[model samples]
Target: MRGIDLFLTLVVMLSLGAVLWPFLFYPLILRMLTTRPEQPGQGQPPSASLLFCAYNEAVAMPEKLANLAMLKRRHPQLQILAFDDGSSDDTAALIAAQGDLVTLVQGPGRSGKAHGMKRLAVRARGDVLIFTDANVLLDAEAIDNLLARYADPQVGGVLGSLHYLGEGKSATASVGSLYWRIEERLKDEESRTGNVLGADGSIFSIRRALYPDFPDSVLDDLTVSMAVIFAGKRLVKAKDVIARERLVAARGDEYRRKVRIAARAWHTHGHLRPQLRRMSAIDRFKYASRKIVRWFGGLFILTGVMAAFALALRIAPLLAMVGVTLALILLALGLRSKGGPVAAVVDILIAYAATLQGVFKAMSGRTVTVWNPAKSR
Candidate 1:
């Protein structure tokens, strides 16, 4: 009985620790170890080529093109390139209408962003390749701010800050916004130390020459950004290179999006395993702490909860049962209401479950390659 108690206690603590360490302890440790400042880049901004892959984004095309035109006007040398992934809508037509303002690549079919990005990389003549999504809008000086970092020869890739809009509109959006804030903080600490783990596809740039070939099913932004580090260069995040995007307002849409992202992220990890093994010891620690631990966070959470229940049952079976039943009832009510603390908790659970599903799906030889913009976003 004592042995059982010890085992259960250890399992509960260890499992919970695995899940919480990334968010709580990792950043603290990172800050304590970080000694250097961000590379204050010098010299003129480099020429840039902006690239995005779109599919059935006709509604967003006009706004995106106008934003691009503004950026182009400010930097006359900035090259704008886009790929229409066989959209059934007027996406390609809108770009075609832009004429000289944009360079367009129309795919024969629904080739994924990885494929479109490869084509764009091949055609990109600028010194840097800036990758953004169709739905994400960049700030006016985002490009200039992104390129300004390139003045430091050590900086091979620059990740832009993504600020989510409409957090108060829905529980899903609020949860996402809070999560991204933590993520941005982690990225800041990582940048000060040595390298950021990787870039978000929403907005990030890499030296065109450093863009590496990756499998279509892999996460392109992660693969491309990590290649910068694999080549012995720094991948840093620039807070000033800002991009704004709306959060997925619907819980279901947000859940599916995370599932897809998590699945591709796992596959991308497998593809980059070789280079990952060769990274510096500290970087390896950061990767394992930030990425690997979080991938299994759902499983850890489950194990922890189960162990807690078992321990509670050992102490008082009747009270444990009553407590858990009440908790479940509360959770159900919260989920139905879809607002306030309870709803946010349920949303987080949904996110973790989705992440776990995606990880296991990838592990079982299934991978997500293509995705659509979240309609609610």
Candidate 2:
């Protein structure tokens, strides 16, 4: 019995370590080993399509159009197009109001963003397709910076840098911003070394010829980025091409977004698994460690909770109590702090919870659809 308990404890610790190492430790080591090079000046321009997918974004379309017009003035030759995903709002009218600065496509019904993107892809006339959200504001140089990476012929896709513009002193916004900073650092290092696992949907560019038509409900960026990688092409992260957006005001808003993202990830895992055998060993490890394990972190947390409970009843009650108490302390600290020590702790906990929620949701054969609006903080 003692040996069995020891083994179980060891297994739990190892599993937790496995999940944390890539997300937390790997970046630290990579940062120490490499530094991002200075971004070069704007190079030769490539004909590109700035694709925006909007869903009920009437309230924000006017601002988006203004930004697009600015981009057009700067890029001059760049083509811009947008799609309204069965929006009940006046989004279509707003796009129509933009005239030729933007082209508008209306979906037959409310299919997902992926469907809208596929529709847009068919009409895209540029050699490169840059996808961005309706609410995000791109800096004047963003499109230029993104296109410059194509100077490297081996680069198939480039990810835009995302910055969160949170309201005055919101803890949720603070934590989210900090999390993205960490993600950016990791991607920067990954790009320097030659591979990026995925791209954020807020902004990312891919070769039009390399574009893969994804299912309407799939996580579009992940699917498209991974497809580029698996095609023997390098997907690089462009730290200089920045896009800025306000963080969803409320923690609930972030949670709802994460749930949809996790659900789409689950679907992506099924479709991409078969291709695993064909990937290089390094890529296989990266996908498994960075993506697969992270998605299941919540299950590990639940298991740890169960194991702690069982151990408390069987033996080493003090150790189990201490562990639980420590976890609570971390959670409390995370809630109180900005993007500092507490935020890191809180992110780990959130990752665990989200992962666990996704697993149970999958096992119970429950499907998550319909967006739940998150409260603004």
Candidate 3:
């Protein structure tokens, strides 16, 4: 009942609220604000360019090239562009062997995906540019679905739904898959209410003219997609326009991937600060809720738990120790990386820690521009 205790309790509450706001309340708020379902307009398919940047993706090249071949056959005019990021593997050769199927651009060195994408974008002559990963496979109708959205002049971009192939394979995969599902739901809501904030590289498309030049350190998908909103156009998600990729099942690989992604995301936030400020109030709310707040999740959870433990200690030292012991036990169980509730919680905590590491790296002006495809994925 002391003022200091009350203040500590209040801090704990606020921290918890900030941490959970994005994951829990944000969706509910979106549901309240969401308008009628978004529907694509009717029209002939747009002239489209499929662009992807690859780094040492030889393992997936054969299947990927075949997929692209199928797409090219489906839409004969679809311009397919590929950038080889100075790979030591046969990636360039494989892409080159396809000859005209893919307009292959070889980078001088490891310039990175963003740099390669910029190069591809410049050469792309299509009306709409579709960006995706080398390993991600799109549904047969994904291109048609994506192109149909641009029938509405107000539609500047469309994000495709991504499904993970290995959800229950491991604790890490399960949590990652579940987290992705929640993200998709949020994107759906964001699309219905307004712009979907940003897009992922797995599958998304934008008007070719709206492609904005950005630094290599920033996340290209997010930067390019958000520009559509900045251009006063809707960036909606089409559930039928789907892409599929395997989840990184190994704990270490997934952790490193999240860390790399988070770090670049934070760096991108810093770069886009001015433009982000110019967004509509509602979009600003969505960005802050869905992105800014979630990035600090690790810090919030740490702060809240420490404050709660301190308050509990002030009340009863034995009870505080008991609670701490129980938490540590659960964390140890999670560290084993087996599938279960305890392991899932541990996996989430580890993810938060990785993300926090990434955010801190961005704060320290360190970022990951170049990347190798996750092997376990």
TM for candidate 3 is 0.97
Model 3 spans with C-alpha error above 4 angstroms: 34-43
Better of 1 and 2 by lDDT: 1
lDDT of 1 by residue, 53-169 (tens): 999999888999999889888988888899988999999999999978999998889878898899888999999999999888999989878888898888899999999988898
Q: Each model's TM-score? A: 0.98, 0.86, 0.97
Q: Residues 1-377, candidate 3, lDDT per residue (tens digit)? A: 69989999999999989988998999989999948455546767779999999999999999999999988889999999999999999999999999879999999999989999999999999999999999999889999878888888889999999999989788899999999999999999998887899999999999998999899889998899999988888899999999999899888898889899999999999999999999999999999999889899999999999999999999999999999999988888778748999998888888999999999999998999999888887
Best by lDDT: 3
Order of candidate numbers by TM-score, starting with the best: 1, 3, 2
Q: What lDDT does model 1 reach?
A: 0.90
- Number of the predicted model whose TM-score against the real structure is largest: 1
- The lDDT for every candidate, in the order shown, is 0.90, 0.76, 0.92
Q: Is candidate 1 or candidate 3 better by lDDT?
A: 3
lDDT by residue for model 2 over 4-37, one digit each (tens)?
7897787678766766776777766555655434
